[model samples]
Target: MSIAEQFPYKIELHVHLDGAIRTETIVETAKRRNIHFPWETIEELKTHLVMSAPPYHLGALLEKFHTFMPVVAGDRDAIHQIAYEFCEDCKKHDVFYTEARYSPQLFANKMSDGSKPPYAHTEGDITPREVVNIICNAFEKGSQDFGVKVKSILCCVEHAPEWSNEVLELCKEFKPRGVVAIDIACGDLDPDVPHKELHTRAFQLAAQYGIHRTVHAGESGPAAGVRLALDEMHAERIGHGYKVVDDAELYERCRRENIHFEVCPLSSVKTGSVPDDLDKHPLHRFINDEVNFSINTDDPIVLDNDLTSDYEMVMKMGLDKEHVIATIFHAARSCFAPPEEKKQILAELVKVYGEKYMKM
Candidate 1:
């Protein structure tokens, strides 16, 4: 076996639960419900889930989700099945820890607008907290069955600050129930977000309640957006902060502040956040400067990736084995677990990876 394959211990800190749903599971769920799919076979269905070769713009990547979400709309059991399978997949990969995130508010009954008619397929009548419970329960069950420590994060969208207040409460209520953090993903600092004020307030309140906070920035947005997410939003970590490397000063600021990056190389390549040139990627700078980072599958199934491929890609890009090990520990330190628990995980990793390679 190759070094990457033989090497054990992995932690994926930036994976999206909704985006990583198994395409087969999706097909089965749709078939069980008698929902029509354009593709009759799973092989054909993958073409829709995975993005095409170049020009992987973030907007186009996000549009792919619309194809699947509607298939299981309003079906709590289907959501549970996906979540359970995510854990099983993690176990197959030998992933020791995960911080999987999903937007519970998206599962709730989407209210209709005054001008437009009600949507035909709605996850109707489901309360936001109910959505949280359904997702959390499945992760908790998966954790017990697969022996993978799972931490769930409640995701808030950039354009729906009005919905964040309920999300804040959900984070607080489910903290002990597997919801460890709250995050904003998708876009960054869009003017269309009517409830920016509400979003600011919700994040502040969540911090007070001891909920961990992260934000998706610097991927498709500029470096300044990452600064805003950190300075104004007080985010502990930045998801896909690829553009931060554009500003040397800001990149230095991240290193100084101990803000870790949940770097997903394949997703970056597929999303066009980084150029196709591996040598030009910011991760090299992050590795050389000793900045903390973690290799992750941002959307494993959606992007046709996994933790092993992420680790393998870094090695293919010439990242030293020692540095690759550092990234793994960096991810472990940022797992949203308490200090004591985090220390325990790090110690176990040291034993597995050998004390010589650890940053400690």
Candidate 2:
């Protein structure tokens, strides 16, 4: 049987909202908005949007965003449609629950101070705060309509520390709505780049004010980045943390502390974060040592994968069906949903997969 057929229910914690936008949405939005997009058809656009080959570096994948983000950024209708469609896509992928993450500032055409936006072609009335509100509203409606629980994680761009404080505030304001966590996403995790003070302060305050934290570290960077995420950022989970295995002491510390590593098998290869050879994947150590981790698709649009694609990648890497089930439980336990909602999610998982898989 196929992995999706075997495990029809799943939980995903590390997918990016911007990275998962539908190609059709981009093409349509570009034409509707008169954005002068060069690619007219979905098939043609995907050749540029999707990373089917490599250099396979993180920077190359991020460059894919520049192609379509400008088309949708700063547009209210486009933002709402993507968030709503994301919920439907989640249900199609059998993702019962998900925490879709993105940088709200990237979606807005203008900053609160009347400055230009990052990805938009021109500045306009929409602010980062408004972007959050739109996504929250869309997610709430989409969840009810699609029968999939979707939450948002506001991201602090690694290169743009200036926006970190506002990202924190947005997380706080929308916590009761649909927002659940704060993450440091985007930009390359270059080891030489000095950690920004503003980013650190925001995360520290996030912890102080009880906002859940996750950081994208140790994917392409060194294991020290993972250590910094745990120490300074107080990350509850590490996103795409494949390199932690390189440092035995740090890896052991993570295992002892039960820090959840969001593993993305296809993405790791697509972005060249891991070796091209699946047999030499660090996930083998993670499985053998019984470290706490969960499988995920980091960027479906760019990597040309969904939840099932990631599951099949790992299954082909020698993981059994039981191992796949355990990761779903790990995601459930590590998700940023409120205690009551989390309980319901766990109960549903048990209902579908049974109590025995919980022990695996």
TM-scores for every candidate against the unseen true structure = 0.93, 0.98
**lDDT values for all models:** 0.80, 0.90
TM-score computed on alpha carbons, candidate 2: 0.98
Candidate 1 residue 329 C-alpha distance from true site, Å: 0.5
Q: After superposition, how far is residue 61 of candidate 2 from its true place, in Å?
A: 0.6
lDDT for 302 in candidate 2 is: 88
Off by over 4 Å in 2: 188-192
Backbone steric clashes in candidate 1, count: 0
Q: How many clashes in each candidate? A: 0, 0
lDDT of model 2 at position 231: 90
lDDT of 2: 0.90
Tens digits of per-residue lDDT for model 2, 288-350: 999888999988888889999888888888998899899999999999999999999999999
Per-candidate Cα RMSD to the true structure, in Å, reads: 2.4, 1.1
- Write the residue-wise lDDT of candidate 1 on 306-333 in tens digits: 8888888989899867777778888888
